[model samples]
Target: MRPVDGMRVDVLEYCRVLASQLRLAGLPESRVRVVVQDVLAHVEATGEDPVEAFGQPTDYAAQWARPPGVLRVLGLMVATAVAFPGFWLVLTAFTSPVPWGGAVRVTPFLVSAVAGAAVVGGVYPWTVGLWLERRAGRRVGRGRSPLDAVVAVLTWAVLIVLTLVVVQRVLGPDGDGRTLFSVPRRVLLAVGHGGMALSFVLPSPGVQTMPRSPADHRSWWARVRSLLAGTGNRRRF
Candidate 1:
């Protein structure tokens, strides 16, 4: 390979290793992408080897690694709970014979699934972080120890078992506490489709826009005007 091609290969390998280390350090995927992109951009600008410029990947990741916040964890739990039922509701919209505006009964299993999902969503990050800390040789915060991993795993297992027991025994098959709420199938369909559409249009928090080039500096109106001028010139010719 040419010298430039070799440098490119080295940079790509470096970035791949850096991204893996950053993830193993418990940094969120979004932050990991941003950091990796920044590093790649710097390397391209200066044409320096990534290892020389940024020390080792693990060391660099250690500098930026951080645990996710409480609010983020809570939000994930809420989203998971909501999505669990929302998916079923959407599926039922197409399959069920119930007419629009008719009430659909919520089952105990659905509620249990939502509860399970919420539990998993909340506990997952911390558990994964504990494991990552063990792998990365870094402490997340104060009061954390190697034993925390074992404790977290045990707690997670217990919670899962309890959820399953509640689903099968306490809830029973069509028990009195089965029906939680009722909503129209049409409403469910609308909400599901709308949410899906919004997700496509909305920019995620993790997405980073690349720097615009000189050509992209022109406004839409300027581009339109230029197109019109070119068309007029073509007609004159």
Candidate 2:
């Protein structure tokens, strides 16, 4: 049977539209382009229309599955955990002790907070990428994929720095001798984080989740572990 005019219009064009929507949702434009191109290629090779091909998934349960790429999610979780500690320090900054036995008369709480943020900004994405690849039943590429890592690191870092700025303002001014540090100190931290983040905007492996092969056999341990992992966990998030 001949395909309809809509189907013949070109699958790549449809992919382009979808990629644009993904970009609007805040995904990196370059990464979206790559994903669109790959998906379009796959569809073309199968000689199937996108809507018809993906219309009914065989594994509906796996669609929302949270296993496999759990590491990526865990990085975000750790970053959240670090934020809590920073919050505690900020709330108690006035009573918080100065560093190195009071040699520096500054808000120790804010310093601790920035340090915690640095940890989140630097390492979160690499771990997340590893987890994502595992979830897709694929081997994660080693060494720094660099681009996606930069994106993940920078996004979290900027968020952390911005949070610290607000916290600092809430703690009061440096001239009053109550702040953890001066505005200049905070500015330097923000600059460092921003520079690190800009390094991650390029498309790299482990950022996009790919479908796993259904025919692949799982070991008994793998099957058991998979069962323990929740099938779907992101509907609310």
Candidate with top lDDT is 1
Off by over 4 Å in 2: 1-39, 42-106, 137-181, 185-237
Question: 9-52 in candidate 2: lDDT tens per residue?
Answer: 34543443344334323455545545555556678688876545
Let me know the TM-score candidate 1 reaches against the reference structure: 0.49
Model 1, 40-113: lDDT tens digits are 78987998877667765556776897433566545544554344344545775676566666876667866576
Residue 7 lDDT in candidate 2: 42
Consecutive 10-residue window with the lowest summed lDDT within model 1 = 203-212
Clashing pairs in 1: none
